[model samples]
Target: MRFVSWNVNGIRACVKKGFLDYFHKVDADIFCIQESKLQEGQIQLELEGYEQYWNYAERKGYSGTAIFTKIKPLSVSYGVGDLDTEAEGRIITLEFESFYFITMYTPNSKRDLARLDERLEWEDAIRTYLLQLEQVKPVILCGDLNVAHQEIDLKNPKSNRGNSGFTVEEREKMTKLLDAGFVDSFRYKYPEKTDAFTWWSYMSKVRERNIGWRIDYFIVSSSLADKIGDAQIHSEVLGSDHCPILLELEQ
Candidate 1:
């Protein structure tokens, strides 16, 4: 089965930038998005054969997520338990017969680190939520997790050390998540590969120079690790500052 995740940055903006073309070309069984920044009746996506699920932030044009799945799930849910109380519309979970797929737009610890505490609380809540799902069946969790777990996951690690997404505390939360029971699929396949990234800064040729952070991810429960065929970062396909990450797994 093929599953894909992309932070479209903004759905309306992406639609104008060949999103449909890329969507048709990829033809994934499931496609998920983060940072949609939209609400009901704002836009329409015509993806045939895909069941669309969207979680919109209560605040207009803010953080949000969506999922388009070819296979209809047995059940669907929004948010990570009490974390949904934040009103940022950050999570969506689709439960299939065999596994659960969750897409999240993790909170960013703003430039000034003013939201660091909230982000940490969100991390803990989401981790517990994933663990609960894993107890029932294997889980595939993917999205713009908003943190680079290690130096290897980004370029210029020393310079970005204490930055919001690359902070030691944020990275440790990611480490704890993986240590709990999940496998970072890309790193599992390419343990030492460097300079590969998902989100790039849209400033001063940073994207052109490939100065980016691997903040997006496709993480699965350890039991599903062996089923992973390939984990890909499509850096070239761009409408947003973030590109799509693909995961191919044996059915």
Candidate 2:
């Protein structure tokens, strides 16, 4: 089975940039997207043979996520649990026969670290939620986690050390999540590779320079580690500030 995750930035903008072409070419068993920046019925996609699920933020053009899967899940859920307060559309969970798939648009800690506290709270709640799901079945967690976990993940690591996505605190939360039993598929496959990134800053043609962050990911419960076959970053696929990441498993 193959799973792909990407932060398209905006679905409408991505469509203009050949999103459908890439989507057809990739043809993943399941595709997860984050930072969709649109509400229900705002855009129409003709994805045959795929069941589409979307969660929209209360605020327009804000954070959101969606999943298109060839496999029909036993059940689908929106948000983490609390539907009223969980209006950011940050999470969506799909229960398959053997596993649970979760796509998340993790909150970003703003430039001034203004949202650091909220980000931490989100981390806590999300981690607990993931663990709870893990108890029931192996979990595939993917999407824009919003943090570049290590020095190998981004260019200019020293300068970006305290930046929003690279802050020590944010990285630690990712570490804690992995420690709790998740395996970052790409890192697990290529632990020492450099210049391998999934997201790039839009400033000053940074993407052309290959100055980017490996923030989007496909992570799974440690139990599925042995089943992993290949993990890749589709760096050349243009559409958003982020590119798609792929994970293939024997499962």
Assess the local accuracy of residue 167 in candidate 1 as a C-alpha lDDT between 0 and 100.
92
- Global lDDT of model 1: 0.93
Model 1 lDDT per residue over 1-251, tens place: 99999999999999899889999999999999998999989998889999999999999999889999999999998866656543888889999999999998888899999999998998898889899899999999999999999899999999888999989999999999999999999999999999999999889899999999999999999999999999999999989999999999998
The CA lDDT of each predicted structure is 0.93, 0.92
RMSD (Cα, Å) for all candidates, in order, is 0.9, 1.1
- What TM-score fits each model? 0.98, 0.97
- Clash count for each candidate, listed in order shown: 0, 0
Q: List where candidate 1 sits over 4 angstroms from the true fold.
A: none
lDDT of 2 by residue, 26-143 (tens): 9999998998999999999999999999999999999899999999999999887653425888889999999999999988899999999999888888889999999999999999
Looking at candidate 2, what is the lDDT of residue 137? 95
Q: What is the Cα-based lDDT of residue 174 in candidate 2? A: 92
